[model samples]
Target: MTAHVAESTITVELDGQVRVVRRTTDVPVRNVKANKPREVSDVV
Candidate 1:
């Protein structure tokens, strides 16, 4: 069996201060692969 891994990094800045955030998480995968059509709804 084989497994896949993914990672990402994000940075945010506000006013004159800067902040860095790092995180790693496993992505959820679906056993069955299928494409569903999307519908658009009006929003008020």
Candidate 2:
């Protein structure tokens, strides 16, 4: 049996077995301010 439950997730059969597939995506960086001060807490 085969089923597509969502846009990024799916279920299918391969090689006489059942499997679930999922999609992944990259995330953008945060707090990207130009000419920002380098605080002491950011010196990790």
Candidate 3:
């Protein structure tokens, strides 16, 4: 008796002509705070 293994592949088509492929992982994003308002300078 013999045993065999099967493999599969994936393909993507974009714009009907271009192919886009990517392997991505989860990434963390940081929250940014807005700057405080500055006081105006008075001219003499």
**What C-alpha RMSD separates each model from the true structure?**
11.4, 13.4, 17.4
Best by lDDT: 2
Model 3 residue pairs with clashes? none
Deviating ranges (above 4 Å) for candidate 2: 1-5, 26-44
- Where does the lowest 10-residue lDDT sum fall in candidate 2? 25-34
User: What TM-score does candidate 2 reach?
Assistant: 0.29
Query: Candidate 3's residue-wise lDDT over 1-44, tens digit each?
Result: 22121233224444565343342533432334446899999999
Query: In order, how many clashes per candidate?
Result: 0, 0, 0
**lDDT tens string, model 2, 1-44?**
54444466657776678778774633432433446686676565
Q: Please, what is the whole-model Cα lDDT of each candidate in the order they appear?
A: 0.51, 0.58, 0.40
| Residue 5 in model 3: lDDT | 19
Model 1 lDDT tens row, 1-44:
22232255445556756565554555544554446888889999
Output the number of the TM-score-best candidate. Answer: 1
| All candidates in order of lDDT, best leading | 2, 1, 3
